[model samples]
Target: MSKDVQERGLEIRKSVLGAEYVEAAFRSADDFNLPMQELVTEYCWGAVWGRETLSLKTRSMLNLAMIATLNRPHELRLHVRGALRNGVSKDEIREIFMQVAVYAGVPAGVDAFRLAREVFDADKDA
Candidate 1:
């Protein structure tokens, strides 16, 4: 992987996910998961999110919809925080989950909403 791409990815990842979170993620990575961390930072964040085509807000919104559809609770929670950081409003998130309910099934929507609320509440307390 290009060092530039990896650097770009780390920058974007820290911006969207917060520096502390990204640092913690790296700090916790063992040999087993270090490569995955590097790949996500370089490719997922740098190669994809670093693109200029879409605004970060738009990307976060899309992620919310897709992750919700996939029913990936952990990622959904993480991205909910990222969405807020990327300027996605709680109202917009609600609408996305509602759309997911229609197309991805009510159960998925329910879980998405629940997870999003948990993030919101946690942020409030923090």
Candidate 2:
């Protein structure tokens, strides 16, 4: 990774993702997954996402759509919550999922909605 990208990426990840979350993710990961996690931080978050072409807001919604289309409920849920930290609103999240349904199918939407409700429920009690 470029020095600038690495510096900016760490700042972006820390600011948007929160240091505690990033630290937790790092601490919880084993040696086998270390490179995979670092690569994602260095490339996915550091390279593609760290670009100034689009705001993190746009990226968050896009990620939500992609995760939903791929039926990655776990990742989708993580991003749904992450979206808020990325400046995506709850209503915006619903709309993002709605758009995803149009291209990815109704089932994808049904699952996303169910997941949304669960997250919201857990968030409420938290």
Q: lDDT: which candidate is best?
A: 1
TM-score of each: 0.97, 0.88
lDDT of 1 at 73: 94
Candidate 2 ranges beyond 4 A from true positions? none
| For every candidate, C-alpha RMSD to the true structure in Å | 0.8, 1.6
Off by over 4 Å in 1: none
For 14-121, candidate 2 gives per-residue lDDT tens digits of 766668877788899998998887877778787988889999989988888999999998887777777888888889988988987898999999899899888788
Sliding window of 10 residues with minimal summed lDDT for model 2: 8-17
Compared with the true structure, the alpha-carbon lDDT of candidate 1 equals 0.95
User: Could you tally the backbone clashes for each prediction?
Assistant: 0, 0
C-alpha lDDT score of every prediction, in listed order: 0.95, 0.83
- Candidate 2 lDDT: 0.83
Candidate 1 residue lDDT tens string, 65-119? 9999998998999899999999999999999999999999999999999999999
